[model samples]
Structure formats: structure tokens, C-alpha cells
Target chain A: MSLSPLGASRSLAAVFLPIKSGGLVDEVCRRIELAVETGLLTSGQRLPNEIELAGALGVSAVTTREALSQLRGQGLIRTVRGRSGGSFIADDALPSPERARARLLDLTRLQISDLGLHWRAIAATCAGVAARRSDAADIASLRGYIRPAAGDGQGATALAWRLSASEFMLEVAAVARSARLAREILRLQADMGTLTLLPFGDPAFCEHIAELSEAVTAAIESHDSGAAEARTRELIQTTTNWLLAEHAAGQAHTPGTTEEEAS
Target chain B: MNGNDAAPATAELRTLVEGIEGRIDDWAAATTRWLNDAGKLSGSAIDKFVRPTVSDMLLAPGSNVTGAGFIASAGLLGPDRSYIAWWQGEDLERVDALANFSPQSMSRYVGAEWFKVPVATRRPHVTGPYIDLLCTDEYVLTFTHPVFRGDAVAGIVGLDVTAQTLERRALPLLRRIGPRAALVSAGGRTIVCAAPDVDAGDVIGPAEGAAATPIGRSFTLLAAAAVA
Candidate 1:
């Protein structure tokens, strides 16, 4: 059996079971999609081999296999033909900027603001909890992700930096010990993944991210939940401000839109 | 630490929890009686039989009830056909029975913890200290109970209470329970607090063996003697 991370199987189970009235298959797909999106199921990490996943999720092996096939078909996961291979999240599953922009365009300004509100709540709460609960090992892992990396202006390099930054935030969420909040942060991070692409390639943005990461880490290490939340909120606001500006620009371009509605 | 010092705090918090639970049970019983007397509680019947009377009964002195009504089903209330009887405030004697639960207003209530959780579980739930700009436009506590007609859930009946009233009700008990005390929601939002330094909506960690108990059918209130 492939070894899953500590409490990972349990947390995944929490997501699946207590299934509300809905399509089971679609629900299963969403949970797995969200898990992968949040980096809770990291890139290249093999899922709890098919049978194990089926057992843990309380679904039939056929159902599990079908879900895995769906993920593979969607390019979110892949299967290798070998003795040791299993279903794994694909390394290059990040959404393209165009895809993200299209998604953003689909939302109303109010919806975007609502999403931002939820994201801020979960992220700030996670920051506070992480500051209170993080141990030395957690601190070390957090620090490891913050070290500066040269992007070289390549698309792949920028993607890697984005993923690393997400990993750092996910680590904080995971360390906070609230699986529920972690799940939320993960989903929000995935949704914001595309939005974050806008600020990429800016050296000033990169420098700001590094400074923020360092500051957040110091606050958490010093057990300052208030500082940790404030810094995280600032980081999230950076994206929120950008999204609001983009939304306003979109409104300006679309004629016949009412001033009241736009506001 | 000596066992004696810890005993009183636990006992005190437990007593407060019991009082709240008793209140919830009383409300549940009163609702049951109302349903029974109405002969049949249906989506349309809620407006005809229940809304007007409950609004009046709830307005009794010190009764804190701001809004009382029923949600017929998941998609029952469109922007225009909203079925709620809401009093504007404690002194607002008039209740608006035909008020529309507007589309813009629905933004704040539809996916809220109070609405979503109870409907899904078919159980009673309490969610709040949240500002409802759509309805009351105040920090309010929403108490919801799923209306079961036979085996299936037909709709839901909900009541809104101002956070100020809940705080007034809970704080004295918390003060007595301290060293430090708080009434935390199931989602870990601190609703009413007697802890000097903590505020509502503060994220509270789990308290071990504190006088923690589930209120209504879905919320867990933790009144810890020690810092949690």
C-alpha cells in the first residue's frame, strides 16, 4: 500500500462522507478536484492506491476507478504503466491565464467580492490558528518554501514559483490543524490561481511576496496571531485589489451598463 | 493543579449550557405545539397560520425575537415570493407579513450557515452573530428548525434574535463560569464572550473537557474555565 501523509486519508474521508443529497459521482469528482486544487493532494503524489482510496471513501472500487479515470481524462491526474506506478496529480495542471480570465469574466463584481470575503476569512483564521499551533518542524517547512528563486522569465519557471507560493500557504493551512479551513483555503487558492497570474513577471511583485512571506513567517514563529492575520490579509488584499480593478475596467468597456449596477 | 479548583469552573459552565439547552428545548416544544394546533404545516400554510401569530408572541417584553417565518423549500423563496414575517425592531410594533426576501437580500441569507446546515441535516441549528444586511441589517442569531411533514422535510421555520439580546443573556453566565469563558458556535466562531480579552468571531481552539455541549441540534458551545 502506498503511504499517505499523516491524517491525509482521514481528512479526505471527512470531505467525502456525510454526503449531502447529490450526484455521488459528481460529488466525488469535486472533492478530489478540490483536494488537488488546494495542494492538499500535491503534484506527483500518488493517490492512496485505487482500492485504498475506494475503501477510505466508502465507494466501490469501480466507482473509485471511474473517478480516477475522470481525473486522468481531465489532465488533473495521470497513470503510469509500471509495477510501482499509481494515479498521480499531473505536474503541469495549472490553469492557463486565458482560462482563468474567462472564468473571472463570468463572475459579477459582487460575486468576486463575495469570493474575496470568504477567502479573507478562511486565510486569516488559518493564519491565526497556524501561529498558535505551529511547531519547530512546521516553522522550518514554512521557511523552506519562502527562499527566493530566480524565475528566469520562463513561463514554466513562473508557474513553478506560483506553485511554490501556493505550497507555502497550504503548509500554513495544514499546520493550523483545521481541516475544514484548509479545504476552504485550498479551493480558494485554486480559484485565485488564475487571478494571481496577472501579477506574475513583475520583479516588484516578486520582491513584495518574498518580504511578505518573511514577515508572516516571523510573526507565526513569534506566536503573534494578530500580526500573522494582518500580514496574510495584506497578502490577500494585494490580489483582491487587482481583481476589483480588473472588474472595474471590464465594466467600463461594456456599454449600456448602468452606473448604479456598476457601482 | 488541585481537582477542587477545576471542579467549580466545569460545574459552572455546565450549568450555563444546561440553561441554554433548556431554552432551545422549550422553543422546540412551543414550535411543535404550534405545528400540532395548525393541523397541517405546509409551505403556504406557514404564512396563513403561523407567521402573524408568532411575530406577535415573539414581541413580548424581553422576548428578543426580531423575525419569524418559514422557508418552504430550497427554491421556495424567489426574490418576490418570500414567506417571512419580520418586525423591524424591539419597538417596531408592526410586522411586515408580505415583505419580499429580495434577490439582493437573499445574497446574505441563502448560503448562510443557518440556512444551509439545517436543511442538509434535517435538524435544528443556530448560526450567527453575523450581520444580515439583507434582512435585519444587524448582528443576529438565526435559529432554524426543519419542518418535517411525515417522514420527509417539507420546509423550515426560522427565528432571528439580535446578538445584543443573546449577549445579554449569555454574558452573566459566562462571567460566573470564569477565570475566562466564551460561548462558541459549532463552526468555532465566538458568539458571546465573557473572556476579557476575546471578541466575537474570534477563532477559538478546542477546549479539553471544558463544559462543552451541543446546543439546539447543531451548535457546540464551549465554556471553558481555562484558556482554550
Candidate 2:
């Protein structure tokens, strides 16, 4: 996902910062705490130090400090106590089907539709632009990200596919030459978080993800913007349709099960 | 005001960019001239063109050209579809980007903006101050012009010049504009900037402000204050 040699994450940091004014500290604390719950801050990832956080979030340093302490109290972030010490997400804050289902169940149909529109727009635009802007190295690097989770029968292949598919999504955005688009996709990925990845648990869905991965890379390599874009949208639409089906059958059956795929 | 100071530098960069454009268009025109009478095109047909020209373009005194050659249109080479006759590197080695060249593989070059834009416009086009990743392995500005067979485009003739070369050659001229001065693409992606926080390739937004002056068809010299 490296786009610029300098810093690509500044825009990512901007996405989490509250754009409107209100009860600033509570809002800052709530947004980040929700980000953690939704798996945006994965296990072991460190939150930026308070001052850095304050600047990026555009909140007061005191506000950032207070928020960090609140998160620590909630067992969301555990701070280390050494030279390298900073707030880190607790190891137990792993993404789970429970969290993903709960989050997905919380979202209304209109909300999911809104998210899909935004996701498809950014994803498709990235592919189209990447097709035009990519060079041989971009093509080579993108090709490397297309490997699907091995059929190891080890039972964690769902998470494995999720990790690789998510990385491929981000990589395509970075290659697009639009940092703005990359940052937006990163934001959407964060907002959708674990719920967006639930479909990867299904072997059929993972196959589709892998196919789209290969197709989009080929289209970009071939410099076919139209095909690259259409394949990207197809990738999202496949996932969206799966999620909508789950939304329709809420709590009726276990997710991450073949039944979800069957529905 | 600093506006007056930036004026001369803007004109200088315009000259520099235009010079690069002129060289690329000349190469493209030379290619079209050869194809007009060559009868049929093939790998050897293109090699003869390169053996006579690539060295002069890449190693000539003060030359910035790093890669130059023909990118053929799809299906122009029998089952081979399209192929690149591009030569690059310090020694000017010949490199062909196609591997399988299957109907599937041919899709790769046909859509490259370097080839696509000129075909669409029927005029010379400049693409990227982007990382080349393919040739020269540096930030590159690719200038491409179409080669025609009858009324249809048969191929493109492209020239690659590293952004570093342009920056190294343009920085002194750019500094006269002011500390925040930058050379940006037509789309406002910075090719070079004096601001410490802004690196090349970050879009500074559309260069329509009073601070911007057109450099070439593809670039602008802007005294932007904010680093986007």
C-alpha cells in the first residue's frame, strides 16, 4: 500500500479525526474506541502517542490523554511502561464472528447501501486509475498479492483469505496514483472493518475474491481501465450481495457457516 | 511582491519542458516517417530503426532521454499481437515488455496512457511524472506521439526522461519562483516542489490559482502555500 515514499498515512489519520465541532474529547474517545471494537486497530497495533494523536485528530493534547486513559480503563488499549511505551490495542481485541455479526446486525439496510456505494466508487476508481498509471513494477507487485489462502485444511483459511484480500484491495488503491482515493478506501475499510471481511469465510466467496484479484490485476496490467474498473465493482457487489443476504437472515443461523453461503 | 521574481523562472521551466516535448515529438515523427515506407513491420524492422537512433538520443551530450522506441498496436505482429521495441538502461539495452503475447497478454500495452492518449487525441501527449517502475526505475515523464498506418494508429513512439533529470535541470530555475514554488502536472500532481513537507507526486489540487503559470501542455509552475 505504499504510494508515496515519504508518508501515506497522514491522510489516513485525517479520516479518523472528527471534522465537526462538539463535545470534542468524548467524540474523539468514542470514535477511536469504536474503531477498536470494529477491528480497525487490530491486536498489538499502537495508537500514536498523545501529542501526535492530538495533532492528527486536531484535538487538544489533554483531550487525547484523557481519551487514551478511558480506553485503557475499558481494557481496549493497554499501555506499555518503557522507553517504547505507548498505548496499544489489547491482544484479546481480536476480530471475531461475534463482533462482525453484531456490527453487521447493527447496520440498517440503507446504511449498508450507502457503504456499498462509497466502497464501489473508491474501489472502481482505484482500478481505473491504476490501469492508466501502473508501470511494470506496479503490475509485478500487484501480481504478488493475488495468491489465495492455501487449502491447508487448517481451518484458519478464512482469516488467511481475509488478510490477503484486504491487502490486495489496499495495494490496488495505492497503485492508482490518487492518494485521496487510497485514503478514502482505507477509511471505508476501517469503517466497514470486520463485517466487510465476513464474506471471506465462505470458500465460494474467497474463490470469487481470488478471481477478481487476478482479473483486476490483469486488467490493470493490460492497461484496460474499463475492465479493471468493472472487475473491481464486481468484487464489491459480490461481497455486498452476500452481506445483504445475511442482513435478510439476521440471527437465524450462525455466520461463517456454509448456511450463510447457501442463503 | 514575489510574483515578479517567479516570472522569469516560470518561463525558463516552460522552455525546458517544451524542449523535452520537442525532442519527443521529433522522435515520434521520425518513427512515423520510417513506417510510412518500410512496407512491413517486424522485430528486425524495428531494430534497424533503434540501432541508428537510440544511442544518439540517450548518450548524446546533455541528453536526458533514458528510454525510446516503438510500442506497436494490437495484432500488428501476427499472433504476437502488440509488442514493445523499447530500449532503456544505462547501456541502452533492448527490452520487450510482452511475455505470453497471447490475445490475453496483448491487453497490457494497448491501454497505457502513453499510447492511449495520443491515439485518442491524434496529437502528442505527455504522461506522468510518475515512478517508472518499468523503465529507468525512477520518476519519469513519458512523452508519446502516435504513428499512423493510413487513417488508423499503427503504434506509438514514446520517449522517457527521468523526473530527477528534469528536477536536477529545473531546480535552479524553479528556486527563482519562491520557496513554495513547484512544477506540477496538468492534474496538479507535483513533479517537484521546494516546500520541505511536499514531496513530488502529491497532488496539490488543480493549478488554477493566481500563483500558477502554465509551463508546457502538461505542466504548471505554481507558488502553492499549502502542501496537499
Query: Which candidate's TM-score is highest?
Result: 2
After superposition, candidate 2 runs with Cα above 4 Å error: A1-263, B1-5, B97-103, B206-209
Worst 10 residues of 1 chain A by lDDT: A147-156
- What candidate 2 keeps of the native contacts, as a fraction, is 0.00
lDDT of 1 by residue, A31-103 (tens): 6775544334556766667775654455678887887788888899899878997777789765456666667
Regions more than 4 Å wrong, model 1: A1-263, B1-45, B74-82, B91-108, B205-228
In order, candidate lDDTs are 0.63, 0.73
Candidate 1's residue-wise lDDT over B74-177, tens digit each? 43333233344344454443232212212323333445566677779977777655545335545567777766544545456677777677677767666665
How close to the true structure is residue A252 of candidate 1, measured as C-alpha lDDT? 73
TM-score of 1: 0.41
Interface RMSD of each: 20.4, 18.4
